[model samples]
Target: MTLLLIAATVAVCLMMLMAWLPEFRAEGALLRRWSKGGGENRCSETVQNVVDGFIGNFSAAHNLSETETARIREMKTRPGMMPVTLLLHPQLVTREKGRFGRGRNLTAVFVATGVSALIMPPLAGMTMHTMSLWLLPFLNTSVFFAGLQLLRCAYSDLGLLNMLVTGKPD
Candidate 1:
């Protein structure tokens, strides 16, 4: 049973690491593009679709006027590498004066996971046993990877905002 728990922890760590790699890769490309100089909209159609969807959602959520939402679609970074709406429409980045901020997603995830770590063992009916000990390692590993992923997402979101504001990804 202990060995099984160990294996599960290793497997989850590997899986989570794999899941994060693509985000980092894409982020690197975004950064390189911004560092060089923003240019024509290089983002894929899928990304454009995602931005459009966000515009729709943001308009609905904020009860934006049709003219206001239309302006969001026309907004683009100075380099024109991607749509500025990608940053402005997201609640995580939106701020007063038409700017962006890190917002609370990353911090909230960290705090929630920390609280859950303290709360889960007791809820699982585990006491001070060898299994419980193994559980701690697994839980720690899970929290570490989960936090890492959330951090990566926040980093990417902020990277986009930086690119929009400074017209540079770096």
Candidate 2:
């Protein structure tokens, strides 16, 4: 059961990695298409609706972000109903997770790994064999990307909110 849990965690982490690749991303098709300008007319209302939903939810928030920050979001924004858009979108795959957010993820991964490493030593009737157990905690970056992905969604949503309030997508 422990091995299974480890394997599942690893698998999700691997999925997180694949989601980071450019060719595999599925969420930014709209934004990519938008950038091309040829695909906007090609985008279905459902696509627009996903964008609309994203925009609506995004626009409703109160934004205190700066102009430059808002400009970046507006320029690089992806089309998705959620900010998992970072993981699921090709456009965002190249961007590293935000600051502070990355630190938080590293803290989580290492902390979880560290705690497990400590506990597993006694459980396994062993000592000073921390490497394998420690590695197990970081088996995949699911936790890391999940955090970044959620934050990207949130910031994008906030960008959307700011845009709506200001009468521009900025």
Candidate 3:
């Protein structure tokens, strides 16, 4: 039973590293674009304006009210806002959790790893060898990193939105 639990914990951590780490690294690179006066924002704006112009003209031709156009113009000011807004919405967040299920599973794995690491040394006591003393601290660090990894996607999206909305990092 103890060996099985240990194996399961190791599997969970490996899974997260294998599945999410590459994507996280790729997306994390975009965070730098959130800096003030970044060139990426300038590029994003050019695209934003084109989209807004298209939408505004479409709405006007369709006989939509000026109020509708105004609202769309307001929305147009914030590039990449709609997708983030939709993904982060309460309903969509729940649906996302249901769809991916990675975050929750990763959390459980990290927590379990931390707990077992913390507990094993004391439970095994004098029987624990020198290397075992380091396990608890290593697992504690792993827990912290795992949490940051889990939040990377949401943080990246928010950073992108901040660049779009405020034209700078917050």
Choose the strongest candidate by lDDT. 1
- Tens digit of per-residue lDDT, candidate 3, span 1-170: 44554554455456545534433442222322232223333446644544454545445434445754454445433444432221321121221311212344445544654554554444344225545445544544464466454455454554443343334455
Compare candidates 1 and 2 on TM-score and give the better one: 1
For candidate 1, the clash count comes to: 0
Question: If candidate 3 were superposed on the true structure by all CA atoms, what would the RMSD be?
Answer: 10.3
Q: Please tell me which model should have the higher TM-score, number 2 or number 3.
A: 3
Residue 46's lDDT within candidate 1 is 59
User: How high is the CA lDDT of each candidate model?
Assistant: 0.50, 0.42, 0.42
TM-score of each: 0.41, 0.31, 0.37
In order of TM-score, best first, we have: 1, 3, 2
Q: Which clashing pairs does model 2 show?
A: 58-161, 59-160, 59-161, 83-153
lDDT of 1 at 98: 45
| Candidate 1, superposed: residue stretches over 4 Å from native | 1-51, 58-91, 113-129, 165-170
Model 2: how far residue 81 lies from native, Å? 19
> Which residue pairs clash in candidate 3?
none
Highest-scoring model, TM-score: 1
lDDT of 1 by residue, 60-167 (tens): 754556766665556534335334323332444444454445555445545545654554454344425445454645565475657655555556655655554445
